[model samples]
Target: MITTLLVANRGEIARRIFRTARAMGLATVAVYSDADADAPHVREADQAVRLGPAAARESYLNVEAVLAAARATGADAIHPGYGFLSENAAFAEVVTAEGLTWVGPPPAAIRAMGLKDAAKALMIAAGVPVTPGYHGESQDPAHLAREAGSIGYPILIKAVAGGGGKGMRKVERPADFTEALGAAKREAAAAFGDDRVLLETYVARPRHIEVQVFGDAHGQVVHLFERDCSLQRRHQKVIEEAPAPGMSDEVRQAVCAAAVRAARAVDYVGAGTVEFIADASAGLRADRIWFMEMNTRLQVEHPVTEAVTGQDLVEWQLRVAGGEPLPLTQDEITLNGWAMEARLYAENPAAGFLPSIGELEHFVLPESVRVDTGVEAGGAVSPHYDPMIAKLIAHGPSRRVAAHRLAAACAQVQVWPVRTNAGFLARCLEDADFLQGEVDTGFIAARLDALAGALAPSDQVLAAAAQGLLSQTPVPAAEPQGPWSALTGFRINGPRQGQVRLYRDGQAVTAPLVDGPLSADVLLNQAGAIVVFEAGEAFAFTGSPPQAITGEGPAGDGVVIAPMPGKVVAVAVSAGDKVLKGQTLVTLEAMKMEHALTAAFEGVVETISVAAGDQVSEGVVLARLTPSA
Candidate 1:
């Protein structure tokens, strides 16, 4: 039995694992980099050890550093909390070789299911259904293009070595295949160090469903039902729920049974997920479902499953790793209620979901839900890691109640300075199609405009901002001050209604406020104020001196700047080159994704400021353009 545990990851997931370990009376150890020395996870652990710099490769991904920390801390086991090196076979093997408990699936199973192509072959041999695709060893561009032609149009190119939509692209036409393939290969090589890819027939309207299966050394393998992760943007899950809606009894049984068969075939022990893609074009059917891939580690969306089933999966992992039998039989485990989770990320939705990095300034969550986060009100959101702020989970006896409650909670959350996707998530929950169980992988893509569009501040929101600004100014004890004091709208003649111009997201709004006693319900901090009104979310605003602001540079200035702090991965333009509007000029990579900076208007390149492989800061000009002569 293990008495001490070391977590081999960082951020919220690491903090989550430590919560269970501390509750179970086990001494917990946390590994962090220089960037996370002041992080919440470090404070939560009983002990922490510094690995190295902020770059993941130098710290969390360094297997030797993690192992050394475990040894130094005298930890008896290591729990890799679902990212970085969690699914690495060599890491697991080394842990077991060193006589430490590996709190995950066996190394053999991880290796077998590491690559998408090899895993599909293994699943096929195990009699599990798979999607139609070319998962061959040949990776020649010409050969793959030929295979794609034979397979048909509208195909998906995916990285065989990684998941999370890193190296995935959808080609809708033959003319775009080459470009898509090159992008997929580049991303795959950067993320997984493997440039190999696979081609698969695209499912137009697909529901992404996966089964949660657990096994122990006693030869007992049982499934914990299914979760629907179809609500996604850019192939990354935005929202997830347990017990897929519209699932029939027959289809559920068939899918779960197949998942069990796949797990047992690999002699899997511990928690694993068997993901499937169901063709929901005509609604869900057992015959229309096919295997996509298997994740040999605990998933990020595991909390919803726990909420519906009343089980702590982390506890199960601990016990199973200590040679315990399955806690419950297949027939004993049953789902009780509906659960939903919304991932709150630090991103600006109106700016094409570009990540926003800065101090959190203020962080508050509703009391009605379960919130898992690793940052506090004064914490910093660094550019060196993923920008997810928290996971808000809600559970109710029915799906409708759960969905509505979760949506309200998402909207009620208040995070300042660093913007979030809270409003965007609320729109998705309130959407008519989503509430009616009409979700699919393509649902977000189809309705992105309606869901993530720029939100205009309402009249009430503007009024609240005005009220907050007035409340901050001090009232004079002596009457009859200078005219400058009247800026507060403190006119002695009758009720004075004055306007205040507030700028938000680069737009200005003028709000009218009446001179009166301020309300005591306003919440304020050094950075801003949050005013709560009737039936509306607490409006967060910061007071700015009145001025006419021009959001653009001076006339004739056409400079392309980096949107975020990232490494310059590619530069496609040079000085003296004519460019068209919206043409890709450079690609900046941050948070494990690439973002292309495009030309704002047609012009000639005046100068190039940066080159490929150079690290650049946010708003640094990469290229400048002038009108063609």
Candidate 2:
């Protein structure tokens, strides 16, 4: 029996595993990085160990450090929660060799599905439906290019060892193939240490569907239906749902059967996911589904699967690791309801979704839905790891009801100090197309402008602010006789303004507070809101804030600036270089993503404030462009 288990990962997954382990009367241990010393997961564990510095490579990715941590904690087993090294076959091998129970699939299974190319070949041999692509061992650039041409234009160059869209590129035309290939190769090499890539025919309007399959030492495998992860941005899933909206009974059976076959092909002995890309433009058809890749570990969106299936996957993982046979049969397992999960990220929706980093001042979510969060109030969102704040999941009798409930929960959340995707996610759930289940990979991309536009602060927000202010005991009409009251100055018939600045969407606005008993008017130049207090502290707003003042205020001279913290990746112009309006100026790499800072008007580069390698903070002057004379 596994008495003590050490999770070799951090954040929500670690906490999630610990929750299940503890419930099963197993001791739990947590490993944290320098930045996560006081993290919630670290505090929740029975014991905690420090791995190393904040950088993932020095901490979570260091195999030796993790092994040492497990050993030092006297942990009898190691559970590699998804992400850091969960699918690393070598890590699993080391754990078992060291006489530690590995709470995951066998290392051989991981090795078989570790690389996409090899996995595709194995799946084909197992009689599973594989996509038409070049999954060979050829690394010759010219030969690969020729293969891509033969496959046809608009081929997808994907790294064999890639996941999470890191080493993937969609080349729409032959003219752009070379550059896309080079970029994908470079990214693949950096991320996976393997530069080999494969080309596949690009499917337009593809719906990403995957089956959750589990196996045990008893040679039994059962699938938990399917999840539709079609709503994506930059190949990263933003929303996921179970029992795909438009799936037919025949296609669902085929997908589930194929997933089980793929798992059986590798002698799998734990939880795994078999992903498929379906051509949804023609609706759900068995012939239209093709295998994409298999995820060797639990997925981030597993909560939705659990909610709908009413199962704890972590417990199953632990049980399988303990050499137990499959406890449940296919007929015994059943899906009860529709479930949806939305990833709430600390990011700016209007600013190309750049990851936002800061302390979570006030993080409050409604109790109507289940929220699995890694960070808590006052927790810092560092740049060292992914900036996901939480995963909000909702379950209902129907998909539409679940989606709507999840959206309402997200909008009701009040988070400050860091910009979040809550507003944007709420808008997406309320979107007509999304509500109708007409979703695809291009959903977000096609409706980005409308989504961003919906992030504008609503009148309800202004009313909330007013209510917050009104809740405070009415500032004495006349100066009170206490030290706390000294700060409140009173003058008859003389108006005094208290300036309060609040940040929204990366821009700070100073609202002049005009104090009154029943009402307060917050004015900022011409854009102001008259907040009327009702029912003691409630407030009602009259008009919307001006749109022109939403962006950065005048900087005394003609210059736009980088509005958030990031690293400069490109400097498109030198001093005295002439540029056109909306010309690309500098590309800032932040939160492991790239964003281009463009010129606001036709101008000349008067002063280059930063270089390519410089790290910048919010409101930093990156480059000054002088308007044309």
Candidate 3:
């Protein structure tokens, strides 16, 4: 039996594993990087070890360091809690070779499915359904172009080792294939250290369904049904649910059976995920499902599966690692009710989903739902890791109720000081298509504008603002004090009217405040209506004063700089290159993702500030694109 376990990862996943280990009476150890020194997972564990530097490559990805920590801490086992080196075959091999229990699938299974191209080949040999595409080993650009042409338009260029949408592009037209390939290659090289890519015929309106499979050393494997992860952004899953909505009983059984077969073929032990792309355009059908890829570790959206199945997957992993037999038979296991999970990220939805980094001043969520979070209030969202804040999950008797409850829980979350995708998630849940189970991978892209628009301040938000203002005791009517008070001018009689600027969702609005105990009037600029508030709280606005009454002009010659530390991955233009308005000039890779820095207007590249592979910090000038002469 494993008495002590070291989790070779950080954030919510580490915390999650620690929760189960502690409950099972096992000592839990946490490994953290410099940036995550004060992270929640570190505090939650019985013992914590510093791996190395803040960068993932230096810290979590350093398999030797993680194994060394396990040895130093005398941990009997190591549980790689997803991402980083979790799926790295070498890491698993080293752990078992060191006489330590590896609380995941065998290294052989990981190696078998580590690369998508190789995994597809293995699946084909295992008699599993595979997508029709070019999974060849050729890397020649022209060869790929020809393959794309033969595959016809609307093809997907995917990295052989890619996951999380990186190094993947959808080409809707033949003319855009080359450019898309180049972009995908750049991303793939930056992300996976491999530029090898594959091509697949893009399925129209496909639903992403993945099965959770577990195995034991006793030669038994079982699946925990399926989860619908069709709601995605840029190929990364945003929302997931168990017992996929709109799934037919026949198709569900077939998918589960296929997943079990795939696991059995690899002799998979512990937890693994088999993802498949289903052609839901014609409804769920066994013939329409095609194997996508396999994730060899626990998934980020596993909470929904746990909620519906009432199983502690981590405990099962530990049992399986101890050479135990399968916990339950396929016929004995059953899923109840419905569950949903929404990934809450620190990102600006309107700003091309660019990751946001800053201090989390006030991070509060509802207690009605399960929230798996890594950071705490006062923790900084460093630019060294994924910008995910938490995963919120809700379970109910029905899918509709679960979605509605989950949305409500997300909306009630109070996270300030850093922008998040909370508003956008709430809007998606309330969307008619999502509510009716009519969704696919292109759901978010097709409804991007509407979702972004829905993030605007609603009447309830304005009421909260009113309550915030009234609760504030204005400066004495006798004397004008600071800049804010002086600008308003003191009044002896009647309610003193002052214009206060407010910022929300990256937009500014001026609220005309009528200094009253109750019943204050606020005129919203965009709504063009005066809202009467009975009682409200003042919403604290940060950054510079509102632009409405400040008459502040735009910084014409000022350069927009990177707000956090990162690496420059792409320089689209040379020093003398000319660019049009809003044209991309450089793409920065930070926190394991890419962010494009585009031109503010038509300009000539005056100075190429940074090159690919250069590490940058906040305010670093990546480029200087001067206005046209």
Candidate 4:
């Protein structure tokens, strides 16, 4: 009998579990690191505990700290929300051994499906079709090449350990196999400490479609249909939707049946996902889809599944952990409508999707969609964790309606100072190919250039910004009302005719005043910039600052400032060193990504303000350069 529940995680997923825990009449406890002390998940829980410092290893991933939190809160059940230790088999064992309910699958099941090679073998043994690959223990390069030849050209070399597209490489030619294999092995070793890899035939046009499977302790497993996750960037899912666009009834039955068989093979309990890879070169078919891998915990995209099936997955986890039978049988479960979800992250897409950490000075999400988030308007996006702060979901009777709704919702996001990928996501959802349901894993990569291009406020947005600026500057009470007078500000009855020059992306745009006022939302951010929400994208404009005020680049004239808050990892140049334009100067590490700061022009380094170990905030000068004579 589970009474109180402790979520051994943070951010959106933790809060997501807590929401369900509350509705089920169960108390909820939250554990957070120093970085997440004021996180939304913490305040929402009935009880909260501080694990340790800002580092995840000292807090979230520290098994002892987590157990202590649960014990202190008197929590009888623990839910390992996705990521961190959600897939750790040993953690699951420890939780159960402590006489506390583990809201997940058995430790044996997690271990069975932990490694790619072993998982495939189990699937094959269970009569579940898997991708044609070599999962043997032999690591000889020559032998692996031979197997690749049999599997045909364009094969993938994937590490057997962890996921998230790390330690994975695609070899399209026989000659490149050896080189790609070595690189994949090196990365695999560095990432997971295991160089062993498996090879599979690379599908020409691959679509990532996975079945959401739920099993109970009573030996019954049911599928909640499938979700199309083909819209991805570097194998990380960006946009996902339930009931794949073109999935036929026959194809769905075949894949879902295989998923059920795979789950039963390990006597799986609780929420799990069986991912499948489909060769969509000839469109989705029963014979084209093959088993990929299984996620032993609730997936990040589970909300879309719930939207389409009208079921609460977290409640299912709790009920099952309490030894209850399946809530609804296979026949009773049904897919209702099309549901789409876009991952809302605090990152700058135009700058290669680097994490952007700062206070949410002007945060506001769209009210037209279902939002699941772990941060608030006044919260800060911390660099100590993942950048994803929320998930936006939209459900409709048809796929097109859902896509349009989600796209509009993406456009309605109003975050400022801290950059976001909202604009990029809106473009992806509104893309012509995406709208027509023509997508594959490489869809985003193929059109990333256009999708992530630097966005400039539209004429309408410029007009809105100009009006907002005019309205706020306190117009002189003595201004002329004559038709010939310069109409510099917005008129109460209509838009006064005038021209306002606004700078965007370093270029000045001359915006002609609209004949009427716009319905666009506008706000004055803390940075003293006039912010206009274009569909939800924040367009901050300045009212033509002084010519000398470039905002950055002090009198030294060659200042290199940190683009975002990060730790200085390397100083490539010293005082008195000459460097060419575009040469690497310093490398900054933030949000698990490394960014190289470069010399904007040929110059001599005059001073070094930071070292390799120093943590720097955005706009902090890292080095000063003087133009070479």
Report every candidate's CA lDDT.
0.86, 0.81, 0.81, 0.87
Better of 2 and 3 by TM-score: 3
* Candidate 2 Cα errors over 4 Å, as ranges: 463-589, 596-629
TM-score of each: 0.93, 0.84, 0.89, 0.87
Query: Highest lDDT, which number?
Result: 4
TM-score of 4: 0.87
Query: Candidate 1 at residue 93, lDDT?
Result: 96
Task: Assess candidate 1 and give its lDDT.
Answer: 0.86
- Estimate, for each residue in 419-499, the C-alpha lDDT of model 2 and write its tens digit: 778878888889999988898999999999988543434443443444344344332222234654444345467765343
Identify the candidate with maximal TM-score: 1
Displacement of residue 441 (Cα, Å) in model 1 is 1.2
Q: Give the TM-score of candidate 1.
A: 0.93
Native-to-model Cα distance after best TM-score fit, residue 308 in candidate 4, in Å: 1.6
Kindly report which residue stretches of model 1 are placed more than 4 angstroms away from their true locations once superposed: 474-498, 505-507, 514-557
**TM-score (C-alpha, index-matched) for candidate 3:** 0.89
In angstroms, give how far residue 27 of model 2 lies from its true place.
0.4
Q: How well does candidate 3 score on lDDT at residue 308?
A: 91
Sort order, TM-score high to low: 1, 3, 4, 2
lDDT per residue, candidate 3, 113-173, as tens digits?
9789999999999889999999998989899889988998899999888588999999998
